[model samples]
Target: MVSCKNVFLTLTLVVIASNQCECGVYSLIRDLLQWNVAGIPIIHKTVKWDFDPEVSQKRREQFFELHGYRAGKYLERIGLGIDGKQRERAYQHAIRDQGKLQGLSILQP
Candidate 1:
C-alpha cells in the first residue's frame, strides 16, 4: 500500500519535473520589448508577422496561438512539459531566432 507521505512526495516530484508553461502565453514580452527599444530587427522565427512573405500571417498567428499566447493561460504553459532535451532544443531555437531582437519590443498585450 502506498502511504500518504509517499503519494505527496510523488505528486510534488511530478509537478517539479513538469514544464511550467502549458497555457501558451509568453511572458518574454518584456524581453521582446527591450529588443524593440534597441532598434533591432524583429523576425518571427516561429511566427511570421508579414503576410507578403512565404509564411502567411494566419499561419504565424496560429503558431503564436498554439505555442505563444496559449501557453500562459494555464499551468501547463510553464514549459513544453516534454523531455528536458527537447525543451532545451526548443528554447535554443527561440533564443537563436529572437535573441537578436533583444532590446526590441514587438509583442503586444
Candidate 2:
C-alpha cells in the first residue's frame, strides 16, 4: 500500500544523504592533501626548469633504466602484501584522527 509520492520522497532523501557522504569524503581528501603539502620541507622544494628537449630525453631514459618493469613488479608485490581490511582500518583511523585534530566531528557510517 505504498504511494508513488512516498517512494519519490524516500528516494530523494537517499540521494541527498549520499551526496552529503560524498562531500565529506572529498573534504577529507582535501584536508589530507593540505596536510601533506604543509609537511614538505623547504629544503626539498621543487624548482621550475625551462623545457629542454635534450635534457628531457636524457631524464626519461634514466628513469626507464632505473625504474622499468622490475620497479612495477616490486610496487605491485608491496601493494598485494597489504591486507585489505587492515588498510581500510588504517585509512578510517587516519580520517578519524585528522577530524579530531581539526576539531571536526566526522562520523563515518
- Among all candidates shown, the one with the greatest TM-score: 2
Q: Model 1, range 14-108, lDDT digits (tens) per residue?
A: 54444464332232433333365334555534574644675687786877777667545333445445556766766865776683453354563
Clashes of each: 33, 0
Which residue pairs overlap in candidate 2's backbone? none
The Cα error of candidate 2 at residue 47, in Å, is 14
lDDT of 2 by residue, 2-83 (tens): 9988975665555545555657655555445445634546646888988777898888777667667547645544644565
Give candidate 2 misplaced runs (Cα > 4 Å): 1-49, 69-74, 77-109
TM-scores of all predicted structures: 0.19, 0.22
